[model samples]
Target: MTRTIRLRFFASVREAVGIAQEELALPDEVRTVGQVRSLLVARGGVWADALAEGRALRMAYNQQMTGADTPVGEGGEVAFFPPVTGG
Candidate 1:
């Protein structure tokens, strides 16, 4: 079954995606945060470049810091952003 999830982009990720937030319907195979990112990376272009593997990026699930292995349920929220630095 397909599930709907909210995506939030911040910092460079927001700039690359050109949007702050969006809702997407995910396929059954896309049940994890990593899979969700893979789906976006499959889009190619800036998406692949921005969220590419080996890049230092951070992910959060439902406002809590987590890894890509985290399960994403229906109506869940996932956020992507670069590592923050304090000046």
Candidate 2:
């Protein structure tokens, strides 16, 4: 079965991906935010470096801050971005 979800990229992640948002059908193994990142990383090159595990990134589910383990359901929305700092 395939799970369809909306993905949103912000700031640097958006610049890297060259898109602000897109919809994708995820495979069965990808059920959480972390899994989605893993799948993107598997794309290698820019994707790998952008969403690399070592990168300091933040995530949200349906506009609510969430951890990597957060569950994602069909038609869900996920956003990725770098930590925000203001002085």
What does candidate 2's lDDT look like per residue over 1-87, in tens digits?
888999999999999988899999999989999999899899998889899999999999999999999999999999999999999
Query: How much lDDT does candidate 1 score?
Result: 0.95
lDDT of each: 0.95, 0.94
Compute each candidate's TM-score over C-alphas. 0.96, 0.96
Candidate RMSDs in Å, in order, are 0.7, 0.7
Query: Can you list the residue pairs that collide in candidate 2?
Result: none
Best-performing candidate as measured by lDDT: 1
TM-score of 1: 0.96
Tens digits of per-residue lDDT for model 1 on 1-87?
A: 789999999999999989999999998889899999999999999999999978999999999999989999999999999999999
Which ranges of candidate 1 are over 4 A from the true structure? none
